[model samples]
Target: MALNLNDLQIFVQAVDSGGFAAAARRLGMPKSTISKRVAALEADLETRLLHRTSRSFMLTDPGRDFYEHALAALIEAEAAESAVRQRHAEPSGIVRITASVPAAQFFLSDHLPSLAVAYPKLTLQLHATDRFVDLVQEGFDIAVRNHFAPLPDSELLQRQVSIDEVILVAAPSYLEKHGFPADPRDLKNHAGLLVSQTAKAWRLHHVDQGTISVSPHCRFIADETLVLLRAAASGLGIACLPETGCKAAMEHGQIVRVLPGWTAGTVATSILTTHRRGQLPGVRAVVEFLAKGFQAERAATGNVLEPLRETTEARS
Candidate 1:
């Protein structure tokens, strides 16, 4: 049966405050109004909850029983409200996040130690996979997606956190053995460590010559970037890689940048959330931390990471 919570509250308050007159003062209402609401509550329940005389009142058998349950219900309801408020106010609890394996390895896992230090009460569960999963059904708090083009329409909130310039790279041994390519078209002669996500033709962009598409002789192909990076480092072939992903290898002299003036493309990383507003503090904290961490990493590497912006979900 449906019960009016307001009436239940009023009835409880009227009884606890000793009388309608006292409850009226506490609630800042007329005594008659309080009496009428309490009476209405009893009428709805079809039970006499109070026996009253000129100046005194007492609870009947059913009244005592109802009062106990009503008081407990009110306490639990208030506690539920308080719990939500508290959770919203503080960054705590577990945040389940998902991202591509390379992103999780290079972009995300590194910042976790500091994030834990900052938010000691919060825990993050990382799920690394290449396939896209439904954030709501999968119970993910946030997702990191890297794309070369605009993402498809989604109900989830999308905020771009970082942008990496895609660059061509190869082990120094490979370049020394095969000679460096002076032109984008020359890549067709050199072996290629291709990424499965890209088309057969590698489309590169140059400032003056514009975009050039080269169908290199692929020696190895993999969907995961980490594998391609390793293959390129081993001098298997020249591979296209994000500047950020290959930064360490370049510094360590394991690989060198190829076609210095040309870029393969640009890939942007974005965070997706189920709801932009009223999110749990832990979820919001993770999102902000990831955004800042990516931006800071790009800054240190001299790459321009674009500022965060909310995306509009396109509808068909």
Candidate 2:
């Protein structure tokens, strides 16, 4: 294989920018040069790095696996240059981060932009997905997840970002038409709108360790929280949704919580990352900033909604 420093750099740039032409623009290089370099690198490895098609460009399985390391190498190299230029100043380099969909909408959408405005020299690469990805293996300096636990690998670490709240609600109008259930079992008569791609019985927990299962067989299930929230807001039926996802509708009083006595667990939001190599200027900077930003966000959230508002049922 003929993979070299330049080839790796080209691959890293393409992944970060999401396309060859875009990477070329970011690096201020000719598109043809970028393509030639990437093609050569793929040829050297005798494996396709990317699955390029007319309307889209995506990393192949090998490409996705190789991307993480390439990203780390490029970041370290840039950090070196930035350090030499600064002399005695702080570290400055590109920091790439990833987050789940809800986390991105509720937290990053605002915070990342503010951070960019504050640090003009800092280049931010943020990607949003609901699926979890390996932070170290994927070359991302930071990955925010809603349900994360400590990884056994000592090289990696995680810190709590926030405690998300999950609440059950239905449109006020719908409740009026179909009398609200006084007990959890009473919901059998009403149509339920569950969230997910497949049908699963909804579960609820009581403070007394007693659990109740509710199945809205005539339920409408959506894959996205946003879709679920809108459906519930329109009085589709009852749904157990995350507080972070339904905060807006609740604020407007379009949907009201039912069986406030029950509780649901949202797991916990966390930032997954590797501890650091001697001096990973870029990754370290992003990690520090993220820790501080999430701490502030968690503090603000506590005031907006009580953390232990209710117990939640875990969905499969």
Candidate 3:
């Protein structure tokens, strides 16, 4: 007997959705029909794939391996169908994207309207949180991340879309009271609002002076970059903030860049996806749209932290 693709797809869905009943609900099929199809799939393979009891259904060892390969095959099959359909019709599908809250707010939110206008048929689901999500397991089609170092090893493919310079910043009132740092070393004497995820020591680099590392006396420590930026703006302390995040505040004179000649570090912002999903038209469209938007924003904000060669007087 030939193995049925529908049976394989049903089996994979059952495993993914956690139970036969759930899969049936998702597929809009009766529970008995779904169970019978999966059983037929196992019979065709001459092995029991799932160990099912009255209360539980568990994958046998062979089932575990089969589920992995079957899931990939189903994804490829769907992509193949999508590609053919897209060749004849418009790109129309849900693309789930995950990113940190600030990235979602500052980088993605404003550009979504343009995407909606361009791809009227397409739908987007955005998951905004600071926590790192497992793209495949979480059913996310793409992820946007900011990293100062190389991303950890993973099967997911990454494409760098933008570079963000991290610079020292402080509110005008705070700088007025605490004084501006003449050199990177002077930062130690100031109260710092630190992002706890950063290195224990702040590593500031200069074009001619090399690198200087300092552990600041932190007034507050937070895991979110946006929180640190807020702390600095509230005059709680100095913060090493991304140039993009602090741009508007600086323009309004709410915050001022200190030590323009030095930078905390450069972080690369990238989009990540599985090799198979990245090839889908819907996913590809979103990625290109985001890449271009970020590039345009960077161009418009040219030379965010260019050194001011001469020390400018602090805000009054």
- For each candidate in turn, the TM-score is 0.72, 0.61, 0.66
Top of the candidates by lDDT: 1
Q: List the lowest-lDDT window of 10 residues for candidate 2.
A: 307-316
lDDT of candidate 2 at residue 60, scale 0 to 100? 89
Please list the residue runs of candidate 2 whose C-alpha ends up more than 4 Å from where it truly belongs after superposition: 1-91, 148-154, 197-199, 277-282, 296-316
Q: After superposition, how far is residue 76 of candidate 3 from its true place, in Å?
A: 17
Stretches of model 3 off by over 4 angstroms after superposition: 1-89, 197-200, 303-316
Model 3: ten consecutive residues of lowest lDDT: 307-316
Candidate 2 per-residue lDDT, tens place, 1-316, comes to 4357787887788888988889999999998899998988888788898988768899889988889878888788888888676544554677778888877877788788877776677788999998757666778877777762433434446565566656678999999998787877887777878765565666778777588887764668786777878898998888878766676688899999887767555556666666553136656566566667766655755623333221112110
Candidate 3 TM-score versus the reference: 0.66
Candidate 2 or 3, higher TM-score? 3
- Tens-digit lDDT string for candidate 1 (1-316): 6777777888888888889889999999899999999888888889999998788888999999999998898899899998688666869889888897878878887888889889999988889987878888888888888887887886878888788999999999999999999999999999988876366678899989999899888799898888999999999999989999998899999999999979988988888888643267888888888888988888898877556676656210
**TM-score, cand. 2:** 0.61
Better of 1 and 2 by lDDT: 1
Q: What is residue 133's positional error in candidate 1, in angstroms?
A: 0.6
